[model samples]
Target: MPKTLLDVDGLTVRFEVKRGSGWGKKSYLYAVDDISFEVKQGETLSIVGESGSGKTTAALAVARLVPAHSGTVMLDDGNVLEKQGEDLRQTRQKVQFIFQDPYSSLNPRKRADSIVREPLDNLSEKSEDEKTTIVAELFEAVGLRPEQMKLFPHQFSGGQRQRIGIARALATQPELIICDEPVSALDVAVQAQILNLLRKLQREYNLTYLFISHDLGVVQHMSDAIAVMYMGKIVEHADRISLFTSPRHPYTQALLSAVPTVDRTQRAKQKRILIPGDPPDPINLPKGCRFANRCPIAEAQCSQTEPELKDVGQGHKVACHLV
Candidate 1:
């Protein structure tokens, strides 16, 4: 069996909201609700969902950036959420985060070199010369020239700025990298370059990635395993090929159908499955399955009881009454 690099069980995150002035109702916003999943060593597990589906929140909770209201995020043997102060800081070095906006993630005032080297300076006891050497090596690894390290973030294009972010994430030699919509902001051509770089790095370094994205196209290219999220729960989880070719849940089917097909003949035969109704309010979620309101095949039973993620066949799991 492949060793699990990360394991998340019963993970839930709830945000409190103010109801009115003076006093507020502590309504829970279940950003991530009772989610359980695992990433094996050196594998890319892409979490896909519509906006506000809790993909980003799940990633943040895994990295221990946001407080997990309940459940455990076990990184190798350690529970990341339980650690604190120095222990948490040390554990964080093993799990780096690559934010979505390269333009905002990078320091506009600091040189690119400084931004990349910042991790090394904070985590490692490396000397000034050692930090410089490491930063230069990282630049080369990410396909950036060493001389360009002195330039500010604005000096590079959007894709290049992302590469710099990648370099910084690599600075600490983390075992797992949580990428939150890493390529959504880039052009189609630029997205490919960054994706290729990430794949190459993962192969060379045996790095595990938890990629969060709403774009099914990019998820198909980068993910070994895909987990589809609806509302705050995982609607389906399966291998890339399985999920793409044989989506069981209505939400997953609808999401995959929306991805534009290149073959005109296939596109002609494909019937687009449009999801109706806006997403339910997180603060006041409907009873039973969250996707019940939007699900095309929703039955009366779906509104009465929530479905649990159950195995169907060949490691495929789905949460739907019909499935």
Candidate 2:
């Protein structure tokens, strides 16, 4: 079995929101409310959810880009949250991020080569010649031409820019790459190319990815395991095949039902599961299950007590009263 590369436990991130007048009653918006999951070496674990589901916040917390209120993130057996100064800087090299918007992420002032080599320059003690050679190789690896390295970010199309972003993330030879909607900004045709490129690079470099996206179709294509989050908590987590074939949580079922399918048999077998009512206020969440109000088959007990995520069989875990 492949070793676990990243392990997150009790990760919680909160934002302070003041409602009333000056220094009024302060409330905490629990963005990521005590979620935990692990990604194995050389595999993708996707966290999928709708807008305001806190998937991005969770990813940001894992990378230490945002302050985690409380949690332990173990990356390659090292406690990421405990690292400081140079220690944290070194940790950054092992865990790089491919951001959502290629247009905004890249620097307009710098050339492609400099952008890609930035990580090597900052993180590693490589010679100038070595860095240059690495940048050239990275351009080739990510399917960019050698001559194009001199061009600015505005020179390339969206997809090409994303490839450059991927190259930058790979510059340090990272163990884990957090892809924050890596292909969402590209065209439909281009999205497939980038995703395939990422998968190819993963196989070539033995990279592990923590992919975050709201698109189930993209998640289905890229994920080895899937975790469904709603209102800052993971409602369900399972292997890709099991989650898609037999979703245990109501939220996961509703999510899968919305995915467009080409297969007629599969399409016919799926019924549209519409969740009614907006999610409860993050600052003042209900005491019971966060999804109880919206769940189709939620019982009286669902609103009285929160369900703990537990494995039914074959590593499939779900937090639901009626599962």
Candidate 3:
């Protein structure tokens, strides 16, 4: 069996939002709600969902960027949520993040080389010469010229900025890299370049990824396994081929339908499954099925009771009463 690099169990993160006026009560936002999943040693396990879904929030919780309200984020043998101070700092070295927005994530004030070397300067006890060598090697690995290192973030193109971010994330040689919609902000052509770079790095370094994205097309290209999130809950989980070919949950089916396909036969027969109704307010979520309001096949039972994510043969799991 493959060694599990990261194992998250019942991980929940809640945020307090004060609604409007002074008289109003503070309601909680369930950004990540009791979700559990794992990423194997060198594999990418993608968390794909809609805009409001808790995929990014869950990744943030795992990295301890945001506080996890309850549950465990097990990175190998250690539970990240339990770590404090120096231990937390050390845990952070093992896991790094590549943010979505290339333009904003990179430091505008710092030079490209400075931004990439920041992680090493903070996390490692290496000498200045060692850091320089590491940074130069990273620049070469990410397809950037050594001369470009002195330039500021703005000096680089959008795709080049993202490559710099990728180089920074790899500075500490992290075992698990959380890529939060890394290519979503780049152009279509640049998106492919970034995606290809990520795959090459993963192979070269044997890195594990918790890739979060709304684009199923990108997910299909990169993921070994996929988890479908809806309203902060994982409604479906399966291998990429299984999930794409046979989505059991209504929410997952609707999401996959929205991905544009090139197969002419499929395009001719496949009708876009439009989901009805907006997602339920996070503060006041449905007691039963969260997607019940928008599910085309939802029955009365779906509104009355929540369904467990049960295995329906093979390793495929779906959380729907009808499934």
- Using lDDT as the measure, which candidate wins? 2
Position 115, candidate 1: lDDT: 95
lDDT of 3 by residue, 1-323 (tens): 78988999999999998888867777889988888888899999999998989999999999999999999988879999999989988988999999999999988999999999999999888999999999999999999999999999988899999999999999999999999999999999999999999999999999999999999899999999999999889999999999988889988888888878898988887789999779998988987999999989989998899998889989898999998
Badly placed stretches (over 4 Å) of model 3 are 20-25
Cα-based TM-score, every candidate: 0.97, 0.98, 0.97
Per-residue CA lDDT of model 2 for 1-323, tens digit only, reads 99999999999999988787857677889999999999999999999999999999999998999999999999978999989999999999999999999999999999999999999989999999999989999999999999999999999999999999999999999999999999989999999999999999999999999999999999999999999999999999999999988999999889889888898998999999999889998888998899988889988999899889899899999998787
lDDT of 3: 0.93
lDDT order of candidates, best first?
Answer: 2, 3, 1
Each candidate's number of clashing pairs is: 0, 0, 0
Cα error, candidate 3, residue 240 (Å) = 0.6
TM-score leader: 2
Candidate 1 per-residue lDDT, tens place, 54-127, comes to 99999999988889999998987999989989998899799999999998999899999999999998887779
Give the lowest summed-lDDT range of ten residues in model 3. 18-27
